[model samples]
Target: MITNFLLDHSALVPVAILLVALVCAVLGLLFADRRRILWALAGVSSLPVFALTLVPTVHTIDEILCTVQFSVPTLGAVELLANVALFLPPVCFAALASRRPVTMLAAGSVLSAVIETLQALVPAIGRACDTNDWLMNTIGAVLGALIAAGTAWLVDRRAQSGSSTGAISS
Candidate 1:
């Protein structure tokens, strides 16, 4: 029933996937020291989101030819927000894995560019190759990376403070 609902409302697919990713990310926080769990969860949850992004519909090569356009005329604020939301998990997970903001940002931006390029080059994919999506996706990635990095930093700082206080008390 849930699958059918998501299929019927294609826009809901990414939202659903994002929710699942968030759950995994929260679970990952429990194992903050071992980032591998975060990576695994994000990777596994991201598969469906990736598939949804590449899902083939009507063959429309016309969109691919216009991939350089910075703005999508048909897209509204909601769509742009959704684009950003869709990529948050992987970006956050990448940050957790390395705690490197630059690495996470680059990875997210590169991944978005690659996906857009693939959509443009592959006619059968039926996905629109829009530069706006790349922009939004990159923004999402950076945002997620910042969030993860900040959280990790806070955790480390708290631990350090606690250890120091303990030492002072001793």
Candidate 2:
């Protein structure tokens, strides 16, 4: 029964990895006073999660039953978007939490590509190491970093306005 379930939801591996990373990031943030270290761990955890997502598998009956089919363009787009979307959360979180958008984004992109390359080495996984995926994922990390920067700016602006008004100065 378990084997059947595993076959049915092979994609769960990546989801599980992502969950673990999220937990680790949260725990690290809570325990580590050093924001830099926490952000670094968050970025590191995101790499394995991204790679697990890229691991391919032969279409088993369970996969078909689960309606896990991708059209060509759709698959292509997913390949492209997955990198960015998958890595964005970690990058954004690190940037927001650490206030280091550029560093976190760069680190996340490099770590993501390294994970993808490592996954390519495993034969049964069926995923090829595509340079394009690396590029798309990097773009995603950059976008996430920008988002983080924007959030920081908004927060700073709000704080400044709040202090100026002094709650009843009007």
Candidate 3:
């Protein structure tokens, strides 16, 4: 039955889809010079994965605990750290790779929020879409963006200083 199928692998299906998308985004960013287009594509690609988190299901607290336990020993820490970790790296990478930090951060945050909302809708996920998650995700993305900005600034400053000193003069 459709219900049975949804029950059996719903969690995994979404996670798998998202993971594939993430991989593709990373590959595209790394190989492609069209940074803006890649960023936009990455942003758009995250939506369905996030939305999957929101789908209603029969998840119980015990189920959530089991999932967390397999990956991390401490459930409490996982709740706090997992989402932040999940969100931060890609945001950082995207921001660093792209010319537009604000746009990347905004897109990442929005996608995260959408995922949280979708998760909230899924009663089976056993996790409510908390405003706290959104806030934390946004903060993580901002931190990533700041790091990217700092790196860019340092690179630019070094380049300018080098040019002024004719470091490359033949």
Residues 1-170, candidate 2: write the lDDT tens digits: 53355346655544543553455444533433466765675567477565565545673222111112333223224345455556666776687778889998898788767755655555455555566666666776886677667766766786789999996796
Clashes of each: 0, 0, 7
Q: Tell me, by lDDT, which candidate is best.
A: 1
lDDT for each residue of candidate 3 in 1-170, tens digit (9 for 90 to 100): 53355346454444433454455445543534556765675466445445435545565543222111123212234343335444655675576567567887998799777766555554476666666567656765775566556655665676689898896674
TM-score of each: 0.76, 0.57, 0.53
- Candidate 3 weakest lDDT stretch, 10 residues: 64-73
The collision pairs in model 3 are: 53-119, 54-118, 54-119, 56-122, 57-124, 58-124, 59-124
Task: Give each model's whole-structure lDDT.
Answer: 0.71, 0.60, 0.56
Q: What is the lDDT of residue 49 in candidate 2?
A: 64
Comparing 2 and 3 by lDDT, which wins? 2
lDDT order, best first, reads 1, 2, 3
Count of backbone collisions within predicted model 2 = 0
